[model samples]
Target: MSNEHTTITESLAKVATRANELCNTVDAQIDNIKNTLKAEQDALQAKKTQFDAQAASSISQYQGKMDDFIESGDNRYQKALSKGDVIVPVNLKHLDDSKFYPVTLYHCKMLDVRVERYVHDDVSGGGILDYFVQLQNWSNGGDFTFAKQFHHSYSGRAFVGKISAASTPYTSSIWLRGGWSYKFYLNGHYSKGPVVIESETQVVERIASTDYFLAPITEVQPHVAANNFILGV
Candidate 1:
C-alpha cells in the first residue's frame, strides 16, 4: 500500500508540473502577440502622419496658385487692356495720325515676368528698368488700349496693377502692391504722375518741388528726390 501511494503521489506531481509549463508557454505567446500588435499600431500611426503632411503641402500649393489667378483678374480700370492678362511693354509708341500717341512702360523687377512662374531676382544692382511695349509692326490699325494693365512681382508673389489715362474724369487711379515706386510717361511727359513711396521711406525732401532732371512740373520736390535716388524714368 505504501509503494502504491508513493507512486500515485509521484504521478500527481508530474501532472501538476506539466500543467504549469503549459500555462507559462501560453503566457509567453500572449505577451509576444501584444508586443507585435503594439508595433503595428505605431507603424500605422507614423504612416498616417507622413500622409497628412504631404496632403497639407499639396493643398497649400494649390491654394497659392488660385490666389494668384484671382488677384491677376482684379482690375481697377473700367476697360480691358489686352488679350493677354498682363501687359509687358516691349517698345510701345504712338502713330502719326493719333491725337496723342500713347506709350506705356511697365517698370518691373525683371524676374517677375515669367508666364509659368513669377521669379524674384535680388541680384545686386539688378533693379527696376523701363519696359516699353512694342506693337506688332504688321498690325497697323491695332490700338494701344489693349496693353493697359501692368503686373508686378514682389516677395515671391505676383500683383496686378494699372496705369490708366489721366484724360478722363478719373483721379489717375493707381494701385500699390508692396513696392518702393513706379514710373510712367504719358504723351512724352515724365513725372507728371505721383511717385508713391512706402510711408516709412518717405522723406520731406522727396516730395518737395525741385528742378531736377525728369522731374514733372507738378511733382513735389520730395518725390523728385526719391525719383533721383531710384533713378528717374
Candidate 2:
C-alpha cells in the first residue's frame, strides 16, 4: 500500500508541473499578441502623418502656380496693347438724365458713385461726368458738341478752337502712355486722315490714366467724347 501511494504521488506532481508550463506558455503568447498589435498601430499613425504632410505641400504648390499664371496673363496683355480701345456702339444705350449711370471696369467693384459734372447742354440734355478717370456722362451733346468738350477747360464756358471732331460716332485712340499723349482714328479706317491730337500738352492735360491702365466710360459717353473714352474698353 505504501509503495502504491508513493507512485501515485509522484505521477500527480509531474501532472501539476506540466499544467504550470502550459499556463506560462499561454501567458507569454498573450503578451506577444499585444506587442504585435501595438507595433501595427504605431506604423499606421506614422504613415497617416506622412500622407497629410504630402497633401498639404501639393495644395500649396497648386495655389502658387495659379497666382503666377494670372500675373503672367496681365503682363502679356499690357505688352500687347499700349493703346486701349473699346467699341462704343457695342456698349451703349440712351437713358434719362434723372437716373444714375454705372460703369464697370476689369470686374472691380465701385460700391458707390458720385457725379462730377452736370452740364445742361442742348444735345446731351444734361451731361454728367465723374472726376478721377472713372467715367462721366455727356452722350446727349451728340458728335460735334461733345468733341468740343474734351479739350475745353471745364470752366462752364466755351473756349476757342476746342479740339473738335469731324463727325459723330468716330473712333478715337489715345496713346494713354505715362506722358498721356492721345491719337484719334475715325471709323474702322486706321489710315484715312491726319492724326489730329493738336498738341501733346492738350493730350496730357485732358486725357489721363489711373494707377491701372483701363478706365470706365458709361452709356451716356459722348459721341464727342474721345473714342477710347466712349468704349471704356
Candidate 3:
C-alpha cells in the first residue's frame, strides 16, 4: 500500500511538470509573434517616410519649371499683347506746338517718373530711328505721390490724364518688362488716375545720372495750383 501511494504521488508530480513546460512553450511562441509584428510596423513607417520625401522633391521640381516658363520671353510677349504697347515719340525733346494744348487738369497725387534716352539699334538701313529714344516707365513702389505735370518745354504747357493707346501702353520691367524691344527701368511718379503711357522713339535730356533741375522740379511740384500759377494744398 505504501509503495502504490508513492507511485501515484510521483505520477501527479510528472503531470504538473509537463503542464509547466507546455505553458512556457506557448509563452515563447507569443513573444516571437509580437516581435515579428513590431518589425513589420517599423518597415512600413520607413516606406512612408521615403514616399513623402520623394513627393516633396517632385513638387519642388515642378514649381521651379513653372516659374521659368512664366518668365520666358515668349510668355512675356503674350502678356504684352494683352497689356498693349507704349509708343515713344521720335522727337521727345522737341515736340510740335500742336501736341501741347492748354490743360487745367488737377489731382491730389502725382508721382515722379524717370526716363533715360539711348540710341536704338535698328538693323534696318532706316537711320530715322537711329537716334530715337525708348521711354521706359518703371512702375514705382510705395504710395508716395507728388504734384506736377508731364510738360512740353516748347509750349510751357502742362498736361495730365492722357495715356494714349495710339501707340501702346507705357511699360517697363519695373511695372512690367514684357513687350517690344524697348526696356527702361525708372523710379518716378505720374498723376494718380487711369492713364496709360507708351513712348517709343522718345527722348529726354540727361545731365549724366545727376541733374541740376531736379531740385527746381521738385519745388515746383509741391506748388499745388489749379491754374498752373502759385497755389497751396
Candidate 4:
C-alpha cells in the first residue's frame, strides 16, 4: 500500500510540472503575438503620416498655382479666360453717347491695360503699353479725326496723337502713350513691380465751327449735361 501511494504522489507531481510548462508556453506565445501586432500598428502609423505629408504638399502646390492663375488673369488649365479673368471697368458709361444729342460724338475709354518687363504672348514687350479702347459715334457723319492724350503723374510728358478710325472697338499696342515707353523699367524701387498700369480713360470732343456747334452753344447747352470721366486710374 505504501509503494502504491508513492507512485501516485510522483505521478501527480509530473502532471503538475507538465501543466506549468504548458501555461508558460502559452504566455510566451501571447506576448510574441502582442509584440508583432504592436510593430505592425507602428509601421502603419508611419506610412499614414508619410501619405498625409505628401498630400499636404500636393495641396499647397495646387493652391499656389491657383493663386498665380488668379493674379495673372490667364487660365492655363482651360486655355481660355477663367471666371475672374476680365477686369472690371472703372467707368462703363464713359463709352456711351446717350448723354449727347443731335450731334455726333467721339468717345474713348480704357478697358484693360497691363505692364511687364518681359514680353510674352499674353504680355506686350518691355516699355510697351497694350491697351483696349472703346469708341462711340465716331463714324456717324464721316471719317472723323480726334486727338488722344495720355497723361500720367510719373511721366513729365503727355503722349498726344491724332487717331482716325471708323466707329468700332479699338485695341492697339502701337503707341506707348503716357510716357510709359520711358518709365517701363523705372519702377524697380517700387515694392510691387517694375511696371504698374492703371486702366483709366479720358475723352475729348472736337467741335466744328458750323450749325451743330452753334446749336449746342445757344440751345442744347442749357439742356445738355457734360458727361465727364474723372481721370482715376
TM-score of 1: 0.33
User: What are the runs in model 3 whose C-alpha is more than 4 Å off?
Assistant: 73-233
- Give the lowest summed-lDDT range of ten residues in model 4: 185-194
Report the lDDT tens digits of candidate 2 across residue range 69-116: 887887754333232352121112233222222222111111111112
lDDT of 1 by residue, 133-164 (tens): 21111112132222232332233222213333
lDDT of 4 by residue, 84-201 (tens): 3432212112222222111112232221122221132222432222222222223333444332322222112212121222222221221223322221211011111111122322
Ranking by lDDT: 1, 2, 4, 3
Candidate 2 regions with alpha-carbon error over 4 angstroms? 75-233
In candidate 1, which residue ranges exceed 4 Å CA deviation?
Answer: 73-233
Give a tens-digit lDDT track for model 3, residues 1-233: 99999999999999999999999999999999999999999999999999999999999999989897887967754343233243222222223222321111112222222222223322232111111111223222223322233321211122221221111122211111111122222222333222222333222112347321100011123222223232222
As for lDDT, the candidate ahead, 2 or 3, is 2
Q: What is the lDDT of residue 85 in candidate 3?
A: 47
Candidate 3 lDDT (Cα, 0 to 1)? 0.33
Q: For candidate 1, give the lDDT of residue 80.
A: 30
Estimate candidate 1's RMSD in Å. 17.9
Cα lDDT for residue 85, model 2? Answer: 51
| TM, every model | 0.33, 0.31, 0.31, 0.33
lDDT of 1 at 185: 31
Give the Å shift of residue 91 in candidate 2.
Answer: 49
Question: At residue 219, what lDDT does model 2 achieve?
Answer: 31
